[model samples]
Target chain A: MAKAHVYITYKNGVLDPQGEAVKDALSSLGFQGVGDVRVGKYIEIEVEKSAPDEIRGEVEKMCQELLANPVIEDFRVEIPNGNNNPQPPKSEA
Target chain B: MAKAHVYITYKNGVLDPQGEAVKDALSSLGFQGVGDVRVGKYIEIEVEKSAPDEIRGEVEKMCQELLANPVIEDFRVEIPNGNNNPQPPKSEA
Candidate 1:
């Protein structure tokens, strides 16, 4: 199994109203130092029984085809070696 | 100046329907090896002339108060040393 962590963010020139809203909210909340705020997406994908490189490629394709808006966003996919396998559910207690 | 990168993700027990939808879309597109998919938010906040620790603290408050739903999401904040400063706008030419 392999896990791909994808991050998608608006390109520099794109207007991000949500981010702006958050920034304004923060200022109203008294964080006067706050400046630029950009909001984006993070996705975790697990691929069963696949090579790390293969999982990386698939994630990139997914981001391009469905996960990100190519016209306004940029995406990055990260696959950690050896730690790529999905972990067994951890016990809470 | 400081920059805080905040990642907000669904808590373990929360249902992520959007993630499931993405998984189904991938399967339909023929990526059988794909398994669990989880989606979240990534936010970047720039704070002017603030200590790194102060920025981190402010981001946590921002996440709890506005950027994330405390009942269903968990957030993490990262403030990289030196890179904490907001980048100067770059010229295309």
Candidate 2:
């Protein structure tokens, strides 16, 4: 199996009201130094294994057609270690 | 400045109707081999630079207090390079 992590975010010129609200809320809550806070979609997909390039092509098509709004959003797909289960975040010191 | 990427996803066992709907849609769209699909939040925060550890502590608090729902979601904070702008995804072969 393979897993793809797709991050869909607003295009640079797009205004994100939700992100602005979150930033303002953070400032009110007294979290100083917070600059810009932008929210986006993170999608995790698992599929039967295929050639890495084939999987990438399938995911790119998925994003273009259904996963992202092409006019206002941009998506990046990362397929980590193509044949393994998703890994947990590494523990920090 | 420093940037943080926070990924928030439903805890194990929580039903993700949106994810399920996306999976069904993918199937209907004739995308074969697509298995489990989970949709989550991807948040990007830019802040004035600080010590790495201090920044991590602040981010953890942000997640606990505002960014994520403690009861239903788990978040992972990634501090990439600590003091640079967000990087574009690397080009694939």
Model 2 spans with C-alpha error above 4 angstroms: A82-93, B83-93
lDDT at residue A34 of model 1 (Cα atoms): 84
User: In model 1, how well does chain A match by TM-score?
Assistant: 0.82
Question: Per-residue CA lDDT of candidate 2, range A1-93, in tens?
Answer: 788888888888789999999999999999998998899999999878667667767887888888898888888877876643443321111
Q: Write down the TM-score of every candidate.
A: 0.83, 0.86
Using DockQ as the measure, which candidate wins?
2
TM-score of 2: 0.86
Q: Please report how far candidate 1 places residue B61 from its true position, in Å.
A: 1.5
Q: Compared with the true structure, what per-residue lDDT tens digits does model 2 show for residues B1-93?
A: 688888888887889999999999999999988999999999999877667667767877888888888788878777877653443322111
Give a tens-digit lDDT track for model 1, residues B14-35: 8999999999998888877788
State the lDDT at A56 in candidate 2: 69
| Candidate 2 backbone collisions, by pair | none
In model 2, state the lDDT of residue A89: 25
- lDDT score, candidate 2, position B86: 44
DockQ scores of all models, one per candidate: 0.62, 0.64
